[model samples]
Structures are given as structure tokens and as C-alpha cells.
Target: MAYAIRPFRKHDAAALADLTLAAIRSLGAERYSDEQVAAWASRHGTADRFVVRAATGDAIFVASDADDRPVAYALVGMRGKEVGHVDMLYCHPDHARKGLADELLAQVEHHCRAHKVTRLFTEASELARGPFERAGYTVTHRRDFAIPHEGREVAIHNYAMEKPLT
Candidate 1:
């Protein structure tokens, strides 16, 4: 199947929201409890927020299908001239392992470099650790934290990783 990568459009916000939830609920379910998954994925359902975020200066890339609907997306934020953060990366399960994420990750680094970003960082979920490591990012540390959700707390652990673009 052929996939296309492009800058995210405002209309893509809803699709990205759906894709985010699906990816989390399915791919993240193995290591996360139901409450944790819900707490995490629930925010992706905020359509307006994602749309506004797409318009932010951040480089938000979406991988689309032949029909032009997004199947995967990655959001990277710039803190200054030298620091970039990979904030979110998700692929629909149906599109998993088909190289869409690989393309997105490469595009992220390319975008960051073009903007003079020399250090790329990401807080990668358990499932995302291997791929980020394979892409030359090293784990700086791992943190366990709780996210307050629906009047309760949900526990999660993720790795802080970095790759030097220099």
C-alpha cells in the first residue's frame, strides 16, 4: 500500500484524534491498565485542541492513505534554536510495521535539522522505546508517574530519550 506524508491540515484534527485513541487502546493496552489507557487516550478525543495544535509552529506530520485520510502522525515541538521534542507519535494498528512511523521519524529529524535544532528528545512509552533506540536515541532515564484522571490517579512509566543531531 502506498502512503503519503504531508503537513497536517486543520481538517485532519478529528482523524488524528480517532487514530490516537485507537493506537493507544490497542497497542498500549498490553502494558497499561484500562484506567490508565483511558486517561491517556481520552485527551486525544479533544478535537478542537488537536486542530489548534496543528496550526501551531510545531512540525506536525501526518501519514495518509490513498484516500488522503491520516493513518499515522507525529508531533514535534521546538523549544529554541537547538532543542526539539518529539511529543507524540502514533500509528493505527492496521498501519503498524508498514514503515509509516519510520518515515515520520525521519521527517521529524529532517524538519528539526532544517530549523537548527541539534538535540532531539522524546519521552517514549514502553512500546516506543525499541524503535526510538533503533533510530539512534539513547535512554537518559525512565520515570514512573501518575496522571490524575477522572478523580483518580493512573500510573505510567516511560523513558526519557535523546538523540544528538550534531
Candidate 2:
């Protein structure tokens, strides 16, 4: 099936939140407990924040859909000094392994190139590392953080990955 990719709209926030939460929850039974997932989802799933971020020209939110409903989305931000950051990249669990993330990354890279960005960076979870690596990102560091969920802290380890854009 063909996917439609475009800039995020204010009305798309609710859909984006759902997609984000779904991606997080799909990490599996052991990666994160239900309590942790629920907590993180509560904060990150806010449609208002997505709208505000999209309104900021510095950030770009792109969504890919089949049949006019979003199945994947990515948020990219241009940092200072020719640097770009992938704030988030999520695909519905059902859509995983179907090249949607790759397409979204390609779009972000194209945006970076058009704007003269020299480097792109992302903090990728273990589950996401392989795809980023295949797309040419190299891990520069590994860090552990406590992600707050349901009034408790859930430890999550992720890699700081970077790739040259130019």
C-alpha cells in the first residue's frame, strides 16, 4: 500500500498521540511494565503539546498514512549550528517492519539537506537502534535515564546516535 506523507496539522495531534503511545507500548511485555507505559503515555500523549511544537517553525512533524489515517509519524527539530535532531519517530506496531520509518527518516534527511544541516542526531531506544544504524547513524554514547511513569521511575537505556548529513 502507498503511504501519504505530509506536514503535521493541528487536528493531527490526537492521532499523533495515539501513534506515539502505541509505539511505546509495543516495546513488549518485558521492556516496560504497563504502569510505566501508562505514565509515560499520559504526558507524551498530550495533543496540546504536539500542536504547540508543530506551531514552532523550528520543529517539523511529518505523518505517513495509508487510507488517510496516520500509521506513522516523525518529529524533527533543527538545532543551532547546522545540527538537526530527530525528536521522535514512531510507527504503529502493526506497521512495523514495513519501511514507513525509513520513509519518514528519508523525509527528515531531505529536509536537513535542503536547509544545509551538517549533522543529524537522535536518542534511540534499543528497539529502534537497528533501523537507525541501517540508515547510517552511529552510536556515540549509551546513557540510562529514569523515565517517569505513574509517579514512579522506569529505567530506560538508549543510545545517542549521530550521522553526517552533508
Candidate 3:
């Protein structure tokens, strides 16, 4: 199936929220334990979250189906207008392995470059590590952390990766 990459729209917020949860519950289950998955997913809010992020200056890109519905999306943030951060990237399970995430990331890199961003970094989930690495990001370290879930701490680990755009 063919997909198009474009800047985010307000209506896409709900779809992005749904896609985010599905990606976390589906693909995220492959490498993460039940507790970890729950904790990770708990961090995601509703469509308002996406709207707020976009409103706050984060650049969001969406990969849409031919019908104009979002299938994958990526969120990027710029700090001091020079450092870029890949804050979130997710694809619906049905759309996985179709190069959507890759294209979205490429769009992000291009967007970052256009804004004079020189370095890109992210805390990449285990499932996302391979894709980020393939995009030329090197793992800086394995970041182990914990999140509060249902009154207890759930442990999780992801790679801290970075790519030099210069």
C-alpha cells in the first residue's frame, strides 16, 4: 500500500493516539514484559496530548494511507533550535514493516535539518532500536528506568541513541 508523509493536522490527533496505544500494546509486547508494557502505555494520554504537543512547538509528522488517515506518526522536538529529539515514533501493527516508520523518521531528519538541527537523540525502545540504528543512529547507552504503575514501580530499559546530522 502507498502512504504519504505530511505535517500533522488537528484531526489526526485522535488517530495518532489510537495508533500509539496499539503499537505499544502489540509490537511493544514482543520485547517488553506485561508490567513494562502497561507502564509504557500508561505514559501515553489521549488525543488532547497530541494536540498539546503540537501546540507547544513540537513538530509532528504523520504517514497517512491513501484515504488520508494516519497509519504512522513521529514526534520531534528541537532544543535551542539546534538539538533535535525524536520523542515518539509509532506505527499500527497492520502497517508495520511497510517502511512507514522509516519514512516518517526520514521526514523528521529532513525537517530537523531544515531547522538547522545538528544532533538527533532518542530513548529508543528495544523494538525501535533496530530501526533507529538502521537510520544511522548509534546507541549511546542502555537506559534502565522505572515508571509508576498502579502504585508500584515497573522496570523498563531502552537505548539512548543519537545521530549527528552535520
RMSD of each: 1.7, 2.3, 1.3
**Residue 73's lDDT in candidate 3:** 93
**Candidate 3: where is the Cα deviation over 4 Å?**
79-83
Candidate number that wins on TM-score, 1 or 2: 1
Please give, for residues 72-142, the per-residue lDDT of candidate 3 as tens digits: 99999865542498999999999998888788889999999998888999999998998898899999999
- What's the CA error at residue 164 for candidate 1, in Å? 0.6
State which candidate, 1 or 3, has the greater lDDT.
3
lDDT of model number 1:
0.86
lDDT of 1 by residue, 1-166 (tens): 9999999898998898888889999998977888889888865676686666555577789999999999999888865542588988899988988888888999999998898888999999987887788788999999899888888887888999999999
Whole-model lDDT values for every prediction? 0.86, 0.77, 0.91
Best by TM-score: 3
**Backbone N/Cα/C clashes per model:** 0, 0, 0
TM-score of 2: 0.87
TM-score of each model, paired residue for residue:
0.93, 0.87, 0.96
User: Ranking under lDDT, best-scoring first?
Assistant: 3, 1, 2
**Candidate 3's error at 52, in angstroms?**
1.5
Name the lDDT value of residue 128 in candidate 1. 82
Per-residue lDDT for 53-134 in model 2, tens only?
A: 6666555545565667778887877655425888788888878788877878888888889988888999987777888888
Clashing residue pairs, backbone N/CA/C < 3 A, model 3: none
